[model samples]
Target chain A: MLPTPKKVTVVAGSGEGDHKLTAFDNALLAAGIGNLNLIKVSSILPPECELVERLDIPPGSLTPTAYGSLVSDVKGDRIAAAVAVGFSDRDYGTIMEYSGHCSREEAERAVRAMVEEAFRRRGMALRDVRVAATEMVVGDRPGAVVAAAVLWY
Target chain B: MLPTPKKVTVVAGSGEGDHKLTAFDNALLAAGIGNLNLIKVSSILPPECELVERLDIPPGSLTPTAYGSLVSDVKGDRIAAAVAVGFSDRDYGTIMEYSGHCSREEAERAVRAMVEEAFRRRGMALRDVRVAATEMVVGDRPGAVVAAAVLWY
Candidate 1:
């Protein structure tokens, strides 16, 4: 079995590039997690995982992450991404992500609601919710927004 | 850095369900990997990784995987998914995935081409290629197909 991550961090950023994938890469660079190979995981925070202020993973390391991202090529298009982590008092936490052509506040609200619903479905009491969100308007080039919960050792 | 996975397995399956997410879930179940938490990784097989006959993951374990999946709700729609792993003689291998409204043969070809292109770009010798593919025609309920290369300890 893979080891559960010991630390997690929330981050959000926006960037622009010539193409969608490059725009996403720039967004991740702006978010401070561009160097690692991200393994996208579904929204489950391991039991006893600790929240950290920042991530310090080595370059090219495999990092498990839960993320929401949106890229738009149309000029003036509004795009937003958000991620939320809901803590439980006595068990594992839940993570949720949202992305759309909307405002940052709307994206954040959607992710928070998703986290709440997830916790409710598990019959777990929500202790706290940590959220990160970003929004941007596309220009001539493609623009991307990314919000993520990075889980690491 | 997170530890590199030592073993990998390829599998494919198709299933039907009431909703898209559940259809995807059912597809995973049919693939014999429904209970594990999948962490989606990009196209890279760790150096010296061994190919295994089957996965033996415990329920709820975090499993790193590279996969392609497609869900269709339109009746008579043909959906397909495929994953390919291209091994190199002296370095890490590359994985590629594709999903679309197509036949299983087309999907497999597409994924194999992607793997070859990835290896060429890296200037790596293509030692071997392993592929898994599946296709399904949607009925009344939503249908999903999944192909995955699961990486484990």
Candidate 2:
């Protein structure tokens, strides 16, 4: 019999040393992001250098929700700093020119606004997020993970 | 836009308190057959039990892999475990019996044999596994996670 798939949530731009979050923390393994600030400062690692290779192929992926003015409404509470993972600038451009309903520019602007607001709400800065890795989940279903991870933090 | 789903691998099983596994060691979460002795104990949880209930639901489910099996083909030192996970038992059963051109019992038997071989190859026994909880996922395309998790460990 086929076993069902395991669910994955990718948190965007979560630092490389997320404390209290080691795999042993909750018997949970993580993708690229980490934040180990709570450890003795000496134990802390740079976000960019600390990236861990994923155990296997990146699973399925989802286009991240555009961060926008509404970001304050959605992630103002829990997020510190984040980046867009799936959606790209080209897609944003196409959406902006021909599609009046919503455009690529709109999407980009929304993401920018959300990223800023999320950071501001947490008293953080863009530079604080040193690296952004595009999580490519290649398989039958790919997009949900992008959403879950961003939403988690 | 929809967000992507991330794939993860977590082994869940119920824990047996005995410092050493005895033949009588029984797991609260295990549902299948196993000898009582030749036991090695670990603290683990069984797969989620609500998998069946959740599998039948439509929108989203927390049920982990509803169907799981591992078929083996071992010739001498070449041992392999063919793993599969499905949305539910019915979904897997039909494929095994009809599309796969194998009897239902045979498909199941193949999986069991392969799984046993896998344990043997790892120098582990079936009785050593202590399942904890089944992690579940629900989405439009949930196949990759299923495959990744099943083949991972």
Candidate 3:
């Protein structure tokens, strides 16, 4: 079993590169997370963890995260990504993420409804919800955008 | 202010496109979330929220979410992304995300430590945690990977 993360943060960034791959790396770098290895995982916040604002991880460190991103080579094409977690006064919570071809406002509104529906399905009363997101249009060069909920030891 | 999300879900997907942007869209579709708009948000799972296995969002509906993604055109290069949330029985939680060039295991380990340290700083004891992630080696065509925490009304 993997070690459980104690605290978490939210982060996002965007960049352009000579190639789609490079653009992604540049975006990670812009988000201050370019140099490390990333391992993907599912959702489930541990009990007792705290939330923070920044990811100060060292370069080359293996990092785990949950996030959404977009990379496009089509000029003038709009891309967006967003993440949100809903929490009540109780100890349980739910998480959601989305990415697509649209404006940031459109994306945010869509995800918000999803958050509310998630709570309704669980029959839980929500107290507050928090979010982070990014949006961009493809230019002459390949571009990328990202948003995430980051966790750490 | 938007309505607070009561529940959230995490998701991730990967795909290859003729171009980098299409690759991201295809990946979102593969993850079963391509049809909706995405709103980015930060971490913080509401207390008492429940975790579900799949997203049954309607097509063309707006959705709120938090996520990380990448698209690469570098052939034979490995890429990965991860997201995790930690929660205690208490009323708080933490989230983390990572992306880079490496194996999935390496990234997962790194993020686990990040979670631990995050809690250590907060002086909180962790009871449990959950995660989502993805990894792939790029081929001749462009490829993408993503992980996310999604929320709904």
Candidate 4:
């Protein structure tokens, strides 16, 4: 552990660009994590971590993040992404990420249930779960939707 | 959860398709998890679970899985995805996922380090870490690569 992440921020964004990869980068920029080196990691909310609405990360930092994203070049197609984190007062937390051809609410609901079910599997009680999401409808240009859980020290 | 996930399997695959969405499905099919409903969940390898190379899953079942995937439309562009799970003798395990325009081995090494870093953050000693990955270069069609950690009851 370089430094145990003491805080985590959930972010979601949608963007349009000339190409698929550029659309993804634009989405990341909209989510406020575009500049950092995103080290895609799995879902775990460390103990006693604080949840924030926004994150201010250093550029070029190795950020451990869990994310779901979709990019589409087809017109009129919907792309959605969602992330949820379930936490208990006395236990570590669970995280979930989902993305596909769906609405933001549907994606959010699915991931939330996943987090709750994960806690249930662990035989732990969850106080609450928080969700973040993004959606986009592809048009003439490539579009992307992204949902992410960013871990920070 | 309905029943606690007692077993986990890691899988990786790559595929090509006419479109980005189809490329993703083809990748999943190559990974042997295409028919099932992938319920995306966070990275907690439950205590007392067994790790296996291949999974015997019933079709249409809701499987809790954590994955990283990338799709590219550029010809000759390389894409890679990797997943790593860190386990200890007396503790729950942690999982990490990574995907990008890189080689498979590089992706695997980055994810493995992320898993070890996660365990270290928790002040836990890791007995070992297991890794799985896939990579491919796009040709005329869109290409996708995925790596996953699937949890089963």
Q: Which candidate leads in DockQ?
A: 1
The DockQ of predicted model 4 stands at: 0.04
* lDDT by residue for model 2 (A16-60), tens: 111111111111112231111001011111122222223222222
Pairs in steric clash, model 4: A121-B1
- Which clashing pairs does model 1 show? none
The CAPRI-style docking tier of model 1 reads: incorrect
Q: Which segments of candidate 3 are over 4 A away from where they belong?
A: B1-153
lDDT of 4 by residue, B1-153 (tens): 246788889999998765564576578879987655465777889898799877886543446788999999999999999999888889799989999999999999999989988998999999988888999999998889989999886
TM-score per model (chain B): 0.98, 0.27, 0.89, 0.96
Which tens-of-lDDT digit does each residue in B56-86 have in candidate 3? Answer: 7788765656566778999987887776766
lDDT of 1 by residue, B1-153 (tens): 557899989999998865564576578878887656688888599999999978897554688889999988999999999999998999899999999999999999999899899999989899999999999999999899999999999
> Which regions of candidate 2 are displaced past 4 Å?
A1-50, A53-153, B1-59, B66-99, B128-153
* lDDT, model 1, position B31: 89
Give the worst 10-residue stretch by lDDT in candidate 1 chain B. B17-26
Classified by CAPRI criteria, candidate 2 counts as incorrect
Tell me how much of the true interface, by contacts, candidate 2 captures.
Answer: 0.13
- A104-141 in candidate 4: lDDT tens per residue? 99999878866765566457799988888999899999
Order of candidate numbers by TM-score, starting with the best: 1, 4, 3, 2
* Candidate 4 or 1, higher TM-score: 1
Task: Tell me the lDDT of model 4 at A13.
Answer: 92
Residue A17 in candidate 1, Cα distance off native in Å? 5.6
